[model samples]
Target: MLAAVGALIIVFPILLLLLNAFKSPVDYANSSPLDFPAALDFTGIQTFWETQNFPRALWNSIFISTMVAVIAVVVSVLNSFAIGIGRVRGRTWIVLAFLMANLVPQEMLFDPLFQLYDDLGLLSNPWSVILTFVVIQSAFGTYLLSSLLGTFPKEILEAAAVDGATRWRTLRSAIVPILRPTLSVLMVFFFIWTWNEFLLPLAFLNTSDSLTVPLLLEQLNGERQTDTTTLIAGTLISVIPTIIFFLLFQRTLTRGITAGAVK
Candidate 1:
């Protein structure tokens, strides 16, 4: 009861944006900002999508986020197995260093990254964004998967080894299958985070051809004041992919979140 009320209070602003997406500009202005639209209409939304090159932005976002997730996940899984199962002598220190790295604010890293990419002639390149998101997400994914792998029952790995499995094969066939829930959490998170990330994209992406959804939304809102409804429409459109992605992975995410609660 109280929880429902709190949830509403938290998301009411977002609800308003959704409601405004379908409202006529005059109705948007004259009516209660919170009121339902007089007529269920999508003309403003259609116009916004048509004018804003949202499809291109959306595609760019999908590409960037997918690359980030796949690359990060692959890198993380290998490294996590290396440090967790292999148990190198200094693994603890390395894991601590990674966790500490995660504490550094992302804003502080962009300038140096931009200059490095500029020197490498990668400015305005999608790889620049894709690689940046991968780097940002890799540390967390490694730490997460390492924690899970380190604690996985030793018997399964031993059984695989007895069956003539090499370490890499055991990791591939045994550990990875067991870690799907946790991996899904990281995959879904990296995708959504990269999709919504604005700062690094804004700093690095200089052209319309590489603009992502967040950057496009920012440009649209910045370009006109009267397009509040249009901007609202754009935001709602932008969120659809993220919502769908989350829904598809909700079970894995829920399990990942609750997996460690008792431990």
Candidate 2:
């Protein structure tokens, strides 16, 4: 069936990566890529871990991604509340501006942001990447959340107002609870997106000590003399955190995605 084939297409590369990660360099070089390895090897994984200081890279990535996701979601909810619920003046123009920002490529803003961060002494600081992505990701988040909030049941808001709930109380007690699933989806997305970022981290986190997982993967890839299996092992390791994070939030993601349809 088409679905089976599509699944295979998506899964095959992952299988390949897993297979090769366990393969010794000699076994990989001597056999076809599809062939099973002669023996399982942990050297590549161990080498990559020890040489790249993978623990530090992982911590840095987790920190940056977590900060971006949390900050961006909070900012998005506030912005959307003002535009969608408050019906702020120039709301349409504000939404349009955010859309325009989303359209603008990150590459185009890199130079200016780089200079700005440098001036602020944020170069090599994780906050540089965290702040940049918080702004960028929240633009998309605000755009999406505003549209979603626009379609939110008006009766709910009116009922809250009738009950004498302040705006902050209403948001904390009502909107957020109802929108938890959607916000969880956005948090997962922002986390993964920030985790996988390369150029932004590469530009700002220039020191080897400050490098993220993706940057470490890039460095592994660039080393011409690095073992092919070792590089694949590094790639495999880099993806594990994202996979675990996604799986942990899988139910919330499904609920968020389906909540709109069910409602």
Candidate 3:
């Protein structure tokens, strides 16, 4: 019961957003936080979809997030193999550098990143956002996968080498299979983070056509203040994909985290 209550508490904001998406501004303002919607007001959803160019935003978000996840996973897996298996010189230092990068607050670097992108003429491009997510996520992913790789049996790698398997072949065919659960978890996490990222996209992208879902939702709130229901509805729409992804990978994520911790 306590755990259930705690879980509800954690999810209360999402619940509120779901309810408000179906509520009028007046209803939302007048009702208690726990109260249900007075009626099923989906006009807000319709308006949000039509006015916000929601389909375009959704596509942009999906494309960027998918690209980021794939790139991050590929880079992380390679780096982990080098550090954990290859016994590369300066591996410890490389790992420490990634840790430090992760420690640095993202807000501190946002300005520099924006300027860099501006200088490169990448502002408003989908690839720019995808690259930003990949860079930001790579440090964490490398750290995570490296730690898991440490627990990997080195003898098996040596045995494969003895059987005439090259290092690259061993990593792809043997190591990656064992790392599937970990990679699955990382994929889901990176997807969620990339999809939900707001600050970077807002700062770097100016064109409405390039706006992500979160940015679109923010625009809706600012321009359509009187239509709070629509804003809420838009918020709900933005979160749906994240919720679905989490649900799909919940088991793999839990198991992966547990296994990584035990190792």
Candidate 4:
């Protein structure tokens, strides 16, 4: 019963989005949202696509999300290696610092980051947002991966050392392969999380040329009269890529989540 309720809770909004995306303006205005549309309308999707220059926004989102994911994963792996495997001095303190950084609210960082970017002349660059999320997301990534690595087998490291393998070789040949499943899960998560980011992107990417999908969707909300169906349609389009991405990685994600659960 609880599982059914949870499923409905998750699926109900998606059903509403689909209904709103195709419902005609006249039908929506006159009838209840729960009621089926008398006729399906494509106007909302068309208008959003044509007027918004959605291609640019889509590309921007994809680039930023992908870069952030890949870069953040690499950074996390490096940090986790030092803290978890290197048996670095103050490892607990380092992990605590990462946790604190992750806990820091984005709202608080916005002003300092904005000013920093302005001073460095990177405010106009998309790399500003990309780098910002890399730093932000990697904090959590490092924290999680560090904890996972701390429990790593000492026997494997000893075996690698006896074989005359260097630290980098051990990490590349031994540790990474074992952690591939977890890393895949993190890549998927970072991609979707970065794609959905709004506040920092909004602050940094003001120009139409650099606007991401979330920023473009906000524009669809409009300064004056808003078209509810158009907004819904834009939202549906924005989520489709992330949905497809999740589906593609679903098996890997499942494996990653279940990796340590059985043992």
TM-score, cand. 4: 0.88
Full-model lDDT for every candidate = 0.85, 0.88, 0.83, 0.87
The window of 10 residues in a row where model 2 has the poorest summed lDDT is 254-263
Q: How many backbone overlaps does candidate 4 show?
A: 0
TM-score of each: 0.89, 0.89, 0.86, 0.88
Candidate 4 residues 154-225, lDDT tens each? 999999999999999999999999999789888887888899998899999888878998898788776466
RMSD of model 2 against the true structure: 2.5
Task: For candidate 2, write residues 1-263 as lDDT tens digits.
Answer: 99999999998998889888888888888998888878989888888887788999889998999999999999999999999888899999999998876788778888999999999999999999999999888998998889888888989888999999999999999899998878988998788778888777888898887889889889889989887878888999988987797779788767656754584
Q: Give one clash count per candidate, in the order shown.
A: 0, 0, 0, 0
How many pairs of residues in model 2 come into backbone collision?
A: 0
| TM-score (C-alpha, index-matched) for candidate 1 | 0.89
Ranking by TM-score: 2, 1, 4, 3
For residue 177, model 4's alpha carbon misses the true position, in angstroms, by 1.3
Candidate 1 lDDT, 25-122, residue by residue in tens:
88888999778999987878987877878888888888999999999999889889988888878999988887765788878888999999999999
Error of 2 at 216 (Å): 0.9
lDDT: worst 10-residue window of model 4 = 254-263
Between candidates 3 and 4, name the one with more favorable lDDT: 4
lDDT of 4 at 127: 95
**Against the correct fold, how does model 3 do in TM-score?**
0.86
